[model samples]
Target: MRLAIYEIREGDEPHRLAHRLLGDFRRWTELVELNRLDPPYIANDPAPYRARGLRVLGPGDRLLYPYAGAVEPVGEEDAEAETYGRDLLLQRGELALMGGTVAMVRGLENLRGALERRLRTRLGELPAHPDTYGHLLHQYVGRAGGEAELRYILLEAERVIRQDPRVAGVRLEGELLDGEHVRVLAYVEPIPPGSPFPVEVVL
Candidate 1:
């Protein structure tokens, strides 16, 4: 995947950088998570002031943003292929073995597996993937209680699921479970107008 590297100039914060680059101030969290930056974004201060939640940009501080590229046209043979995407099948977070070899998942199952993985991954945790590829649902783990928070969780879950190209759209509802875990119930509308399937993701 191609990415845009943004240099942090003097007096730049997450919101300002996001607005200047992504054109949306609301996407500041995406900036912060993409750069794996914590609060009090001090330059080189070992002891940053913790009372205020302000960000300070340092020299040579830069951010990375995923850039969209032109999609390659699919051939007739590829279009007729059965699977949306393919990968080694994972059952219960472990490789599913078949005849002493790793089994593979294809078609709708592969798509489901991919969606689940994307939803469960914490943002900035996977170095191989674009920093914005995963969900930020973990942030609400211990703080979700009120109706507004629940609604935000559901919306964020839907946003993350919809990022998958295989998923045309998604309807999500958030349920708070014991141990401060949030469960996202999703009804995924796949590309090519297939029947919507139910998926559950716990974060």
Candidate 2:
């Protein structure tokens, strides 16, 4: 298995929030120790890792950090198909969120066409923008609430991804403190044979 560790350093306020939510000031400290990170891998300092491009985390940034367990592709065909499907979903989701109706519809149509061409499978119909809007609204509601709610939402998202057959496992790497606040770094792993993703709760 190939492992890639992505770290996000919490800003001062976020760090405090984490402590409050987890009800343990040393929760993060414990995790850092458990991970056996070296002296330079300090949780309080985002500098060293930022210089190495591992610090992509930001305030309100929900990241999806992927860890590929198998260095070798399960098989060229499966790997290609999985990659294509995931990329298409990401692209479509982003376009749907940012583009206005006219643009979104156009983008969706384009995505459908592209997916069909690449996978020989129709992506089926696209949901109305209002429906998408409502979904997003619900998500926003969940994310905007207290730390407990935020943790629930994060866990739920992880569950959803892990349930997908294409994903082998998922890991949640972030700080969840006691005060109902969080700093997240999440990732997904795909198994050789289709299986739901597994999650490793980092901290």
Candidate 3:
């Protein structure tokens, strides 16, 4: 999946707020590591690097902001002022990363079957219908307590439309809402007649 990294600035600094709000330092670090971010270069004494307008982030362009000692997601609009406790800064230290967009699919049900099969081996008995999508399943990994077992099940429903020879393109639309939640909607169109949607299954 494509990932983009945006550094937290003034309004975006969730780390600072986390400490002020939660007063938990260890939890904040855990959030950072979970998102695959490098260990933070924070300090009690502000220096040039702290003043500099760049911060390195991890995979998927996701950053964690410390809120009451717990790391949380910070949106683009809130990044600037959240960086520092002052006026919003225009140019600040930030970085980004991107990934492949060519996703493969055959059909919704086919994709659902594939996901169910794959996850069953890994997570054991998964919860049915965790969210709005009828095809999705949820499983909690990691530990029994804490944020260890939080995992979302995604049905790669776009595969069916994409694999069809008659279909020119397939787009999966969705939103990555707060709290790492995702909602997907499928859209498909035919390429030409005679050459209908492919019936063959790849998996």
Best by lDDT: 1
TM-score of each candidate?
0.58, 0.29, 0.19
Candidate ranking (lDDT, best to worst): 1, 2, 3
Worst 10 residues of 1 by lDDT: 46-55
Q: Mind giving the per-residue lDDT tens digits that candidate 2 earns over 61-172?
A: 2222234343655565444443323232334334434353423232223223332222211112233211111111124232445655666646544533332223345666
Q: Is candidate 1 or candidate 2 better by TM-score?
A: 1
Task: List lDDT for all candidates, in order.
Answer: 0.63, 0.35, 0.32
Error of 1 at 26 (Å): 32
**Which residues of candidate 1, in runs, are more than 4 Å off?**
1-83
User: For residues 39-80, what per-residue lDDT tens digits would candidate 3 score against the true structure?
Assistant: 353322212222232232312122433333344665543332
Candidate order by TM-score, decreasing, is 1, 2, 3
- The true-versus-predicted C-alpha distance at residue 159 of model 3, in Å, is 25
Worst 10 residues of 3 by lDDT: 87-96
Measured with C-alpha atoms, the lDDT of residue 8 in candidate 2 is: 36
